[model samples]
Every structure is written in C-alpha cells, then in structure tokens.
Target chain A: MRTIGLEDIDDIALGSSLLGSGGGGDPYMGRLEAIAAVKEHGPVTLLDVDEVPDDWTVAPICGVGAPSVSLEKGTNGIEYPKVRAMMERMLDTKLDAFLLSEAGGMNSMVPISAAARAGLPLVNADGMGRAFPGIQQDTFTLNGVSTNPFVIADEKGNCTVLYTIDNDWTERIGREITTASGGQVTTLASPMTGAKMKTSVVKGTVDYAQKLGRIIRTASDAQGEEPEAFFLRESGAMRFFKGKICDVLRETRDGFNFGKVTLEGIGEDKGREAVVEFQNENIYAEVDGEIVATVPDLICLVDSETFVPVTTENLKYGKRVLVVGLPCDPAWRTEGGLELAGPRWFGLDVDYVPIEELAARRTDA
Target chain B: MRTIGLEDIDDIALGSSLLGSGGGGDPYMGRLEAIAAVKEHGPVTLLDVDEVPDDWTVAPICGVGAPSVSLEKGTNGIEYPKVRAMMERMLDTKLDAFLLSEAGGMNSMVPISAAARAGLPLVNADGMGRAFPGIQQDTFTLNGVSTNPFVIADEKGNCTVLYTIDNDWTERIGREITTASGGQVTTLASPMTGAKMKTSVVKGTVDYAQKLGRIIRTASDAQGEEPEAFFLRESGAMRFFKGKICDVLRETRDGFNFGKVTLEGIGEDKGREAVVEFQNENIYAEVDGEIVATVPDLICLVDSETFVPVTTENLKYGKRVLVVGLPCDPAWRTEGGLELAGPRWFGLDVDYVPIEELAARRTDA
Candidate 1:
C-alpha cells in the first residue's frame, strides 16, 4: 500500500487526465479538492486489489455527467462520502476500501478525497484503466458484475438509490437522474468482493498514473527526449500524429458532450489532416481517410509543450497537440467487452482493429 | 368503509376522468387492471381517512408520466405492489393502507389495484382532488408534508428510491427517471401517519367521484337535463362553453403532452370560439379571448351528447363538446398550494381566480 499525500496530487491528476483518454472531466478542481482533503485528514492509503482481504467489500465511486457542467458547478466534496455512507447504511455492511470507478481524468482523484474524508483506504485498481462514456463500459460489467444497487448523491445532499436489472439500464437510469440533478452527481456502485476485484479490476493503474505524471513533469528540452516519446516508450503507445487543432464541433446531447475535433498535421506530418470523434471520451481517430485508432483503444491528445492532457471539454481551436494511441486492457478486447465499448457499439460501421494492427498497416503502406 | 368490486370500476373510471381535467392519462387501462385484480383477489376495502388508526402508516400510490404514453405502453400490473413492497422493506414498517395520490383520471384507479393485490384497505381520499401535472401540486405538499423518501418502480421490476430535500425535487427527479424508464413508472410517496392523513388529504373524493359517475351514466335526454347542467348543479361547476372542436395542436415536451385545442362555438353561442390549453392536464380555458378558467381550478371537456369525458390524449377534431369549470379544493387556494399549482406557476400571465369568481364576473358582464 502507498500513501497519497498533498505532494502527490499534481502527478496523480496529470497522469489520470492522460489516461482519461480525453474525458473523465478536468482534474484541476479534483486536484484542489484532494489537496484540501489530504491537508485536513492526512494522507490516504492506496491498497492494491490483491492486498484487500477476501471478505472485504469494495465500492467504486466517481462523478457521472457532462464534464463541462462539472467544471462550472463544482462539487460539495461531501457527495461521494455521503453516497458511500448511505450505501453502507442501506446494506448494513462496512466498506473496506473505496475503489476508483475509472483510472482516468478527475475520477481518479475523486476517490482520494472520499477516502481521506472517510478515513478509508482507496484501492489502487479501477474498473476502467481508461475512460469510457457509459458506466456499463467497464471490465466489471464485462465480467458479469452488476452495477446495482447504485447510489447517487448531488450537491444538495439529495440521494437516489437505484436497483436495476442490468448495467445498461443502470447507465440509462443513472444518466437521467444525474442530468435531472443539475447535470452532475457523485455515484457509488458495483460493490465487489476482494476476490472478484482481483480478477475484474484493472490493477496498478493508480501508481502507473502517478509515474506517468512524474515522467511528464520531469521531461526537459535539454535532454532532447520529448514527453510523448517517454509516454510511448513506457506505455507501449503509438504516436498517431502531431497537429494543430483547426476546428471543433461540440453539442450536448442526452447529457453527454458529443462532437468531433479536426486537426491540421504539423512538422513531419505537414499537409495531412486528422479527425478525432468523441462522446464524453475520445473514441476514435482517422488520419487522412485512414482509421488510425478506435475504441476499446485509447485515443488521447496532449498539449504539444506542457504535455498536459487535453480533455474533450478542453479541446480548443489553434492549440497544437500530439495524438497518441494505446492498447486497452486485454479485458476490453474480449467479445463481450468489444460489444459494449467497440466502434460498432458507438454506431460506427467499422469493426474494431487494434492500434498495433493499424500501425502495422501504415508501415506496410 | 366501502367495498370496491368489479362493479365499481366503470363509475370510478368515468368520474375520475371527469376530474382529471384533461390529463391524468386515460382510465380505460387502469379500470381493466383494477377489474382483473379485484376478480382475482376479491373486492378491495375503502376506508375513510379518519377511520385509519392514528399510529398506522399511509402512503399514496400512482403512475407518473405523459398520459399519451401511459395509454400506449400499458402496465404489467406489478409495478405499484413492487414499489410498495420495496418501500416497506426499506422503512421496515408495514403500510397500514394505500392512499390514492389523486382522485382523477388513471391515478384514482391505480391504488385500488395495488390495495386489492396487497389485501390492504384503500383510503377514500387523495392528495389532489383533481389532477395536476406535477406531484408537488398536492394538498400534502401544501400542508407541509415532504415527498421523500419517494419510491418508483418500473414494469421490469427495477426500482429507484429518492430522498430529496423537498417535494419539487421529488417531482423533477421522478419525472426524469419516469421519462427514461419508458415514460411511465409507478410511484409510492408522501408516506404519512393516519393523523396527518386526515388533515392533508382531500377527504371523501372516492365517494364523490362515484356519485358523479352515476350521475353521468344515468342521465337521459328525455329527462330534459343537460349533463353540464347536472354536473354544474352537483359539483358547483360552471359551463364555460359549448362548441365543436375545430383544431388540436399537440407536442410532447419534457415528458408531458403539451398543446392547445380550439373549438368553434355552435347553436346559441354561434360565431364565437374557445380554446383550452394543457400541459399534461388542462391548465386554462378561454372563451373568445376571455379567461374563463385557470388552474388551480379544474377545466374539463366532455362529449356534448354522451357526456363522456374527453382526455387530453383523445382530443379530436369535429367532436361536439362542453367545457366545464369547477373550483379546486379549498386547500389548493392557500399560498403554498397556489405557489405550486397556480396559473403563474404554469407560466401564465394571469393570477389564479376561483372558477366561481370567474363565473360571477361573466354573469356580471
């Protein structure tokens, strides 16, 4: 187990945002909240999924809604713990540790605050190693873990407990409630036993995020190795392109930020263009009429200089960014996982081809 | 106390539809379900609010959503009981009786089915004497009763329990969930003690509805008494206008059937026109641009010949109908009630004037 102190907030936020795959919401506010929480309640203990006792119960907690709205509304900081408390009261069982629902974006940091406040340890693993729009698009769901009874708490302390038949219904109903509750809600769901967690969770993502954050932070131009190169080398990620954002189209539909971003290729890739489409999270990227990457793979964008991740809500015109692709957790490549998080699931006609395959095809061409 | 068997379904449906004020959804399906329930479980006992034991717990049960959708979707006959059972399990208290949430349209009959199935008594009173589009627009709300912890159940056996700060949040969040859960959900809320029920409920509405239904069913042209005249005399309602429908404009918005119907005056009122506007329930009626009625008062439309109530969903062209107005329950005229159910609350420019006062003004003019 590792302790997350105030000093670790920056690295965790930066790393999680990169892993957020351009969603999960901005981590700035989450970082601030975590700092305050750690200051007030001391450091939070982060436990590996395997370290948890067999009989222990772990619940995943995260914010669910439009990331843009979450930036404007902010959170009360009490929503997660309140939801956790309610769940415990309802179930008559103590939660052994708080699990991050996703190891990407602001959600990766949210659990730290909840853990600090509740004086509980946070599991180092997450349901999703990277972000996906719907709650059902997770390893736990693919592995047959139910998403209910789910608890959602809003800023006003109002709480809703949902018991649904399936994870899809959980997403449908939870989205509606979150939208109605002013477009942002903290949720605790998918409680699992330690044995189940060991198999279903994407393990070791918390420490990996912090390490990634450190890599981005320590990179120096004098060293001649770019932050992107370091990320690609360590994570087995592919550099899709380096480009300046030329245009962006975004709309809020069904409580999700959905749209596309167009980029004009820069440097070695000059004159070529690329487009990345997203629903809450960056889902797919096409480079000059060729599919470079698609979900269940990670399509991420980073600032050309600072290497800070550009979340979907922060995508802007005129900013130069490096597009990167990484393979998703092997669980996501399973038929059931692909059915839920694949391009076809998002209504795209193409079958999912891994990022490595696409890179090899590019090399051959 | 009274026993409501299969024989009572027709009268209850007829009377409740008249009280629905063009909303509440159609009572046909509810009546059929109630009949089937009573046939299988024997008759349901209806007890006066005062007859309930002072220490017993009472809860109102009803369906919430657009009336048009409820008709098309129909019910599986298990949602209400499921919600009630869930509520009992959550609260760890047995509900002594089931209370009707409203004494209008389909809602008036929903509790009967639940009560019959549960083998519990149905309270002969309701939160609303006439239907209002929102759950917060009720006597219980006006009298300081909270709507949480509200329970909603869908046909798929999925249930949601909401603990909101106030009744309005309950309506807002409940409506959102209902819309997402296929536009209709069974809800049991505003659980109260028997003593609170006596003061907060619109007492004797069940018998009143039955009596009004009998009046409508037994009326004959040979009697030389128009249905409107009989209705006005019995309920102290007023005949707003007599005309044949010329046009109907409808659109579903935010889970409600919102629109207006225009009527061309005929016979004694020839060359004149009238309009009835609705949002789920008819909220306003105007005769030749003069406001004849507005909520928190009742605006009803009936077939000119058969005297059958015309629900919002069934409003059609070329049907000769009589528009009627009745004063809302006196409790609804209170400051709190008006704030929730008044014309201004519905975005109308006018203040809430009692239907009797409007009738007097018309007579004076």
Candidate 2:
C-alpha cells in the first residue's frame, strides 16, 4: 500500500499482531489511535527505502511498560508529539520520517499514529522484525547504534531526556522510569539516518504485516477458505498446536508481563498437551514435553475460527486457539543477533536452532 | 566563614553532622572530597545572601539515595559538575553561586566541593536548615518553588534534564534513577534568584554548623571542658539522653536507609530505654514510653565523650552516645513547612511540637 489511510489500520494492526508473537501489548488500542490520527491529519505516506534521501532521519516513537498495565491504560496521545518535539530540539535537527520500533502487535501501529500526527511519511522498516522483551534486543543495538540522547515522557507531562552509558543502562533506567511513572511512558530513542536504516533494520516488515492482515481479514470473511489455512499457506508458517487454552498464569513484575499457557490438544492432535512460556511475548513452546518452538522465532496464538490474533495479555482459559510459529528475520538468525536475544541470552538452557529446522523435524516425526 | 578553606572542612563536616539529625549519610568521605577539591582549586568563597546581585542565580547540588549506600559508595565527584553544567545549559544562564541543598552532615560538604570545582562562591544559605529524606522536605518546596528543570546525573556520566509537574514527581523519578544507577545521583534542582534565596532558605546555617564544629573540636582537644557540655552551653541545645546503644537495625531499601536504634540510659537516667526511628533522617524518638521528639526538629546522636556527630548509618551497639535536640529553623515551624515535612509527612503519628517545648516539659516534670 502506497498510503496508510484509515481503512488500512485494521489490517495493519491485525497483521502486526500476528508478527507480535503474543506480545507488544494489545493491538486494538494502537489501531484506534492510528485511525484517529489518520482521520484528523489525512493519509500518511508509506515510503520504500528507495523513496527517501540518504540524509533523511527516522526514529521510533514507542511505549515501554508491561502489557498488563499498558493494555488497560491507553496512551493519552500527548506524550507522542511531546517526545517527538523534545527529540527534535535535543538532536538539533528535524525528523524526516517515523520508523516503527517493531513490527509487532500494537507497536506496528504506533509509528503510523506518530507519522500521521507529525504530518510525515513512514518507512516500511523496524528495529526488530518482531518485539522482544529488552531494549538491547533491537537491530539498532546489534548494529552499533547508541540509545543515548533519548527522550521519555509520561502522560502527566513529566519528561526526561536521558543519556546513558549503553543500551543496558538505557533499558534499566528506562524501565525504572516506566514502572514508576504509572507503568507506561512514551519514548523517542535511537534515531537513525536513512542510510543507516537500510543496513540496520528488518526491512519491509510493515508491508509484510499489512499484507498478512489483509490476507487474514479477507479469508476469514470469505465463503470457502478458512483464515488460518490461508494465513499458513501465504506466510509459510507452521502450526505448532491446535487446542483450547486449559490454563494460563500471568504475573506482571518490574514492568513486564511474565506468563505461561497450557493448551489441551484437539482435532488431529487429540489427548495431547502443549505448554507455552512468555515474558511479554511468547518465548518457548513444548507439546507433550518435547520442544517445538522457541525464540527468537515468532510464536503466535490466534482465535481458531476467525484467525484474530490473541496477545499474551489477552490469553484466557477455555478459549479455543491455534499456536503458530514463523521464521524470524534472516538478520535475527545471525551470530550477533542470536547472541544478543537467543535462548541463552534469556537465561534458558537451549541453543539457537532455526524454526524451519525444528518444524521440519516435527513434521517428519 | 568568608571562605571554605581546607581547614574549615573538618569543622563544617563536624558541625553539619550535628544538624544532620542522624541522616545525610556520613561526613568523612564528603570531608575528603571537599578537602581535595579545595586543595586542588584553592578556597571557595562563602557569599552572604546580600553579597549577590538580586538577579544572580543560585541552586543546590546534592546527592540523593540511601545513606547506607551513599556513605560506602561515596561520589566519584564527576557527577556534581556534570549536573551543574546541564542545569546551566538548560536554564540558559550562568549560576552566580551555589546554594547548599541542606545544612546537614555530608551534604553540607557537597556544595563546598562543587563550588571549589566550579570556582564559584557558595552562599551561606541553604534550602533546609537540616537534611531531610525526601526532596520536597526543603524550604524551597515550603516557599512554593517549583522543582522543574532539575538535572540528575550518575557517576558514569549518564544524565537527565528532568521537568516534572511538582516536587513529588521530582522525588519519585529522581529516586528511581538514583536507585537504578547504583544507588547514587548528583542533582542540581530548584534554581532561584538571589532575591528568592534570601527568603527561600535558612540564613547563616553554614556559619552555625562551622561554629558548632569548632566548639566540639576545641573542647574535645582541651583538658578543661567536656565537648558535649560545651556544645550544649554554647548552642543552647538540650541534652535529651546519655546512653549506650543496645540494639540497632538498619535496612537500605528504595534508596533510603530505614532504621531503628534502641538505647539504654547509662548515666543520670539509668534503667531507662529510648527508641529512635529513622528513614534517612531521624523521624521520631521516645524515652521511657514518653514521646520526646519528632521530625521538623533536630534529633542528633553524638559521641558522649568527644561530641563528634554520629550519623544514622554509623549507629552501632555498645557505642556511648548523647542524643541532642536542637531547634529547627523558624521557617520549618511555619504552617506550610510543617505541612510539607512534619512528622505526619514521614508517616510518624506524632505532632510536630518544637524540641524546646518537649525539653521544657521533661525538665519541669
């Protein structure tokens, strides 16, 4: 899509939620915010990397906190442009476009809202192919970009322009502020140039999410085809499990929603059980005590019938669902990316194995 | 004291500790830092409020965190000037002098070091006549000054120029950053004009602390007089109790040392028990089941023999000490000041009757 008009918000939000892997907070709020902005300011131009000059700058306007809180307390929308303005003044330059922080759940719509409100175009790229739990889990951190000179602002108009030693400092300080400031803050961090964006981001994830959203919407409402089956075929994703959510355990601590979900298998996989673990996003999944999926691969849960994305925060008991896994961006599979956000980085006793390999083995067995 | 030479540091440190009311961390490290600063850059001029132009700018550079942590992890000294520079840049004006945040313990020495390093005069005035646990406990907050446009920085060069809606926001956000950044941060906050400083701060507190320090030192060194008696005679301070510390419990949490000290009367009042409760600064004290003193009043613990100040962080079992009560600033007795930092504000159940009244009742009975 060349432009993100009001009508595209649902598809993009839906598509991005699938990429969210059951995290990035709920996408519904972001969708509403993006729709309102587009309606008020007209359609925001969606630009390809080639459409912008090399010198153009792009930065993400994102929120940081737990899904447990952010889902309930939606953005007031003032913090968005306040952070934007502070960033512009602090950096002593004008922003040319907005870059999505991640092509996951609600965040996929955050840049849309920010760009539309600022009357600027949005580049179809993101720091992460999908959202991860930590600030250091971004492509910008992997590509040697500093998280310094960033701005964080709360809805009450309290703001701090922070400069830290590293991304770890950025995460700790930022998280502390987020948790203390009513568990949510709008942030403008890690501004990258158009030239750097080409090499430092997961490209076209915005376009991909929008396409997937469209595919799911059209197929779900169609006469013959089913949404999940269409999504599986079009996105080349593997069905990790098909079952009903038997139990879910979620606890929000230090501004993160850590959770576990147990699914009782159904359909062809009757009489089996599947377990999924998540910290803000789904991190690992096992069926009958065998490892089936793990991050940094996308592990998404969706409604069994309508193919609507169900975030980790929205997981509930007695809900029929399908567990899906998709290959992460090629960059995330690199040695550097794996070291930065792989299972070991998250304190898990597992090695980095591509989802394609794991899914191929599961199918073969 | 017209200038803060290296020799004056010991007396200031000693005297300030008396005003500390068992808070403001420990004075030894701050003394060393101030001495080194003065030795390297010569003396820092001590300016009376009237010496500065009416339009001259003044602000406080102080440390915030648990006295338990701040005492052990003394400032690296870099953070002080860094915050000062950020405040200057953000306010877009040069500071004419440094105003001590409080006239208590280590903090009183902090401004001395900061002023010497910057080659600026240090005003004899201070925001609080005694050091307090929270940022809002200062006279500036009492006088209706805003804490916006403050700067906080850590030893590692990470800094934030913060703007909050009120002092409470400033305290929470600043404390969060301080705790997360290894539990120490230097802050430059509440810049006021020379005109405001005259009415907004306690006058001649530096001189008062220095004179008290001199009384303790000379009396302890001489063979003729006992330091504690000499101190009481000179300052018109009342001796609350003479005892040996029987038990002490201190825990550093959320960047403040919460503590309790149980003292058993040793001389003149044998078989009597006294309990003191503190959060950073001494908040309440009770002797033999009678409410003796509470906050908005100074409750100091000093060595029984030498009369050297004993900070809350340094309280230990078996130490022979004298609990002294000095009158707090007259401003702190005002309705606004009492409402801001009275006993109830620190969660104490006692009302803020001046120490003079409490001591007079005990003497009469």
Top candidate (lDDT): 1
RMSD of each: 1.5, 1.6
Runs in model 1 deviating more than 4 A are A221-228, B221-228
What DockQ results do all the predictions give, each relative to the true complex?
Answer: 0.89, 0.87
List per-prediction Cα lDDT, in the order shown: 0.88, 0.86
- Candidate 2 ranges beyond 4 A from true positions: A222-226, B221-226
Give one digit per residue, the lDDT tens place, for model 2 in B214-277.
9888876656766656778886777888899999999988888898999999989689989999
Q: Please report, as a value between 0 and 1, the fraction of native contacts recovered by candidate 2.
A: 0.90
**lDDT per residue as tens, model 1, B92-203:** 8999999988876789889988999999999999888999889788888988889887999988878999999898899889999998899988899889999999999999
iRMS of each prediction: 0.6, 0.8
- Estimated TM-score per prediction? 0.98, 0.97
